[model samples]
Target: MRTAKRPLQSQASEAQKQAALRYILDAWEEALHDGIEPEMLANAALFAALADLIDLYGEDAVAKMTTGLSRRIHHGEFTLRRTAQ
Candidate 1:
């Protein structure tokens, strides 16, 4: 029996990783709204590590992740980094 190979583009790309990071941050925001202390920084770090494993966008992915993170932080969600300190 022969197995089919997956297409290269079908694999997780930098955009996909960035989208995932956005999703994670969104969830974190929701959690914050609900008074849950979600580990936003930890999750972001993990996502970054995972992003490094893929062969897609490196800096671009990080930039998107930062943007999403900043937006959430500005909106009063759980902060990954202290802004006023």
Candidate 2:
């Protein structure tokens, strides 16, 4: 029996994604140890990370992803309410 091989582009894309995640985690660990604030990190990191994503994925694909992201955010949004103990 033989296993089917993944398409080259799929394999390459997965490899690139893994590499990018590793790179992000490494940089984040250093920044946190250096006491970078979470709010500050989110502000700067979002732009940098999205720019890198747009560079890799192209504007149209990223734009589509953003629409999906907005949907997820909407679903994840919560309301605060007072509860009786």
Candidate 3:
């Protein structure tokens, strides 16, 4: 028998999300210390992320989802540091 699959967002709790980010950040810092360039790490990370997303959600759906990223980015949703203007 086939089991039903849960939606991606419903699969992880908010705390799980934070923990996941922490783990990724730790690995990122470790890679930096091991002499990997940030740009190279970023490119690999993006490629890995997009490839996994496409595998799970398909290229069209992933493309549609990422279309809003431009607006979100412009709004500084991903900004971690800000300087006084």
lDDT by residue (1-85, candidate 3, tens digit) is 2222323344678999899889889999999999999999999999999888777766766777789999999999988679899
Q: How far off is residue 69 in model 3, in Å? A: 0.9
Of candidates 2 and 1, the better by TM-score: 2
* Candidates' C-alpha lDDT: 0.61, 0.66, 0.80
Worst 10 residues of 3 by lDDT: 1-10
Arranged by lDDT with the best first, the candidates are 3, 2, 1
Candidate 3's clash total is 0
Q: Model 1 clash pairs?
A: none
Q: Say which candidate scores most in TM-score.
A: 3
Candidate 1, overall lDDT?
A: 0.61
Summed over model 1, clashes come to 0
- For model 2, the superposed segments whose C-alpha errors exceed 4 Å read 1-11, 54-61, 72-85
Candidate 2 residue lDDT tens string, 1-85 = 2222222123357789789778877887799999998688878988986776666666666665677766676675432244676
Segments of candidate 3 deviating more than 4 angstroms: 1-10, 83-85
Residue range 1-85, candidate 1, lDDT tens digits: 2122222234668899789879977976777898775576567656766565333444544454556776787787765576675
